[model samples]
Target: MENTNTLTEYLTERQKFVNDEITNLIKQMDAPLQLKDSMLYSMEAGGKRLRPILMMASCESYGGNYKSVMTIAVALEMIHTYSLIHDDLPAMDDDNFRRGKPTNHRKFDEATAILAGDGLLTHSFTVISEDNQLTSDQKVFLIQELANASGPTGMVAGQILDIEGEKVETSLEDLEEIHLLKTGQLIKFAIVSGAYIGGASTHQLESINDFAYYLGLIFQVQDDILDVSGDQELMGKPVGSDENNFKSTYPKLLGLEGAIEQKEKYVQKAKEALKSAGIKNSLLEELTDYLSNRDY
Candidate 1:
């Protein structure tokens, strides 16, 4: 990886690149002005941009140019944004705010928000298909992987489980399963797919896959932790919304101390997986630590 820049600097530079690319891609889409506006609204609404950054970082960790996976990275971000848009709909989480702004459904009409999410999700595949950097086989593999992660079997299944779990008490095991699918699957795709495109060996892929799973759990645990004890202004949304929704969370299931302990366990496991993959002292490791302790 590039050793000259700190992680903060690297993130800022890469985020700008990803944002510019997303804008360019949206401009090329021959869609209605309203639809495009809704899509851009959520896309430009700021978050960590963690998924695309992880994909790019993973590729570079294996000695591949970040540009080699840039299109796929953007596609992953689009899918993530789509999920957030739909998740905030009235029929779903009924969230009014996201990233400190009115959600898509609130900014526009519910129907238009739904279409914007649909446009982004479907158009992501088109973006990948048009990438000149990847071979036909690579494109096919990535598309299948992304579909399996975000489609009915992966994130969708987890969403249903989360909804159901809200009505009843949930076990630790059950909660892990829900998050592993809901949050972890896409995270797994971001890292593993990037590494594969960067020319990882089969053995390395196996180890990194393990790392991704633990990292995903860490992310959800921290999210749950933040819901219990985070600043609304910093997070750009109200905390304790989980309790309001009666959703089961790490802090709820395991207590605050237990949740912190759980995050640490996952952090250690993630580092172990990285060491086993022969990937050490890299951006992936740094990002893992950051996720464990993030306040928002």
Candidate 2:
């Protein structure tokens, strides 16, 4: 495994690359100035860029050129950004800030924010369809994967479950199901789609899917922990939003200590999945540790 410094550098470089690519793609799109501005506002909001990074990493792991998958990675980020925009709407989380800046709705008008999200979502499909590097079959597969992950069966369903889950005392199992669909589905797509683009075998895709599943749970568990203990400055938002919003969380279902224990278990499971797949990816291994141990 690489040392901490090496891993940090690697992540930083890849994050910069993703950010630059996102900016370039947005500029290339021909849309109304205000709409493009709103989309750019949210897209430029600082984030860890984890999803796209994972996609590129998975592609490289399977000996596929990362550049070949760059369009897909960018589209994933656009979709994710659109979700965040809609998630912060008044009908949703009603968050005022994201990434330490005004949310899309807060930065612009609510209607503009909603439209910006719609624009980004539709533009993502155009991106995939227009990418010259991918064959028609590859494009179709990517579009299908993105649609499945973000549509009714995936993130949208998860969002509905989250909204409904907040109204009642939700069980641990139910909470897991909500997150698995809501948060885990797109994450699963990131890993699996990358592997697909890289031409991974069915067996390899299954293993990576398992690894992503555990990682998604760990990601949310850590978010729960951070909500209770994280610094607002580094977190880029107020802490305890979950409790304030009366949302169900692992730390709420299990005690804080128990939540930490659960995160650790998922971390181990993620690593074991990679091992079982006979894959050797230092970045992915370190990512598990880094995400679980993150302060923000």
Candidate 3:
């Protein structure tokens, strides 16, 4: 049966569950107090918790028990949080604030922040490997796939390209490549891993994977759009930072209208791919619309 809950209500309930799990995970860690604090600072700093939610939604779409993938979902969120911690460091984006709070580097020492990111990144794999719910093969598949998605050929590669592209003009194709890897890989992992664990047929997995790819692009495109037009208070950050940084964005490459059109195209393709996977009237379909239309 389709989820009857509105997206708002669904996100609230799922976010609370994810947050509780994250807090418990941190409490169980044997890390130093400072390190744990630093890690938790960013972890608790509110955002949409989109990655974990996506994994949960994908699994549910395939009739799998959401609890079965809960550990993986939390691990995925840890990875995302770690990336944000580093991305805010002076050596990187040098962002001082995130989610309206001082960034990890600002709240804690840079060294501690770096170590916190490292701790989160490395420990994510540990949680997955140690999870009692998954099979050995499932663990192997997830660990390898996560490494591939977040490592050199995936998000990191995309990040470096984004940094390099900032110094020079970037074509629309180049921009797409940058975002697809930097932002899309983990998103792909969230959906693919969840669907795989949820017992999707191979053919269905292929279609769902395609849907995830487009959704990732849609996410980035909307991010670019929000950078230009979103409310600063709601976003918990200043608008126009992208412009100030002179970074290549969808809006910069293609006027605001063009970027919106591009986002619409991605949304349409995402829906088609979801339908192809034989998933209909599910939370995934609602999320496709919600993500693109989100203000923050």
Candidate 4:
């Protein structure tokens, strides 16, 4: 009960901080009214703010001030939001709803939605590059990291693989590879970027990378579980869309019970990585469990 309360309070405070930072940053942008409005639309559409909060948590765990990493956190969220906007396009998943609200394309026109995504993606780099707190070297490192995570060899490649895999049966290893690129890359950026900003030692960074990798797999596995068994109202989107789209998933490869077991395995792996890293961050450990067990 005490652990639950502490986790709840920690997530609440950090989520509020991320949401406020994102809102303020978007508001300060000098852009067209319609574009700004479109951009803010998805930004305000509610979700867990997982990436930013994870970034901040990782930073705090490494003895760095959360405020120092705020810009990067916000940038990570912007990139994530942009991806969602694009993912909902007619040429993509073609979803009409997000976070219980009209998707960006549904709320606005397709062209506007595309531009909104473009604006957010470009502006994220500006936020990172222009931050005064980070040195130029750090800014370059972050830019490279984000590019590698989201560019052709990373999330985009994973997305292409997913689209292609929908046509045929994909091996479990292949599916894992696809998700590692599509989902895991950005997640890795969130954790590693924080450690980088916090000036972690080489050994600490390696352990943190291991933790992030396993945690990413756990995150995707839980998502697969939710898509099969989650409440639509709480999920803010239709469940079983993976089945509808004929996408390969962990639950499809492994049975539902098997998928749950797989998630637990990765959760344990993540915890072990943290232990090996000698990082005594209870919140980070709790977050891994919370993510695995989340209903939405």
**lDDT for model 3, on a 0 to 1 scale?**
0.92
Global lDDT of each model? 0.91, 0.88, 0.92, 0.89
Pairs that collide in candidate 1 are: none
Using Cα atoms with residue i matched to residue i, what is each candidate's TM-score against the true structure?
A: 0.98, 0.96, 0.98, 0.97
lDDT of 4 by residue, 1-296 (tens): 22336787878888888889889999999999999999999998987989888887788788787789999988988888999999999999999999899999999999999999999999999999999998999999999999899989998889899899999899889988898899899999999998878778889999999999998899999999999999998999889989887799999999899999988889989999988765646767888989999989
**Model 4: lowest-lDDT 10 consecutive positions:** 1-10
Provide the RMSD of all predictions against the true structure, rounded to 1 decimal: 1.1, 1.6, 1.1, 1.7
What does candidate 3 score on TM?
0.98
TM-score leaderboard ranking: 3, 1, 4, 2
- Candidate 3 lDDT, tens digit per residue, 1-296? 34535779889988998999999998899988999999888888987989999998899888888888889999999999999999999999999998899999998899999999999999999999999998999999999989999999999899899899989999999998999999999999999998989889989989998999999999999999999999999999999999998689999989999999999999999988988997634789888899999999
lDDT of 1 by residue, 7-108 (tens): 788888889989988888888889889999999889999878899999988887787788888889989999999999999999999999998999999999
- Candidate 2, residue 38: the lDDT equals 99
Check candidate 2 and list the clashing pairs.
none
Off by over 4 Å in 3: 1-4
**Steric clashes per prediction:** 0, 0, 0, 0
- After superposition on all CA atoms, how large is the RMSD of candidate 3? 1.1
What C-alpha lDDT does candidate 2 achieve relative to the native structure?
Answer: 0.88
Candidate 2: tens digits of C-alpha lDDT, residues 31-145:
8899999999999898899899889778777777777888899999999999999999999888899989999999999999999999999999999999999899988989998
Sort the predicted structures by lDDT, highest score first: 3, 1, 4, 2
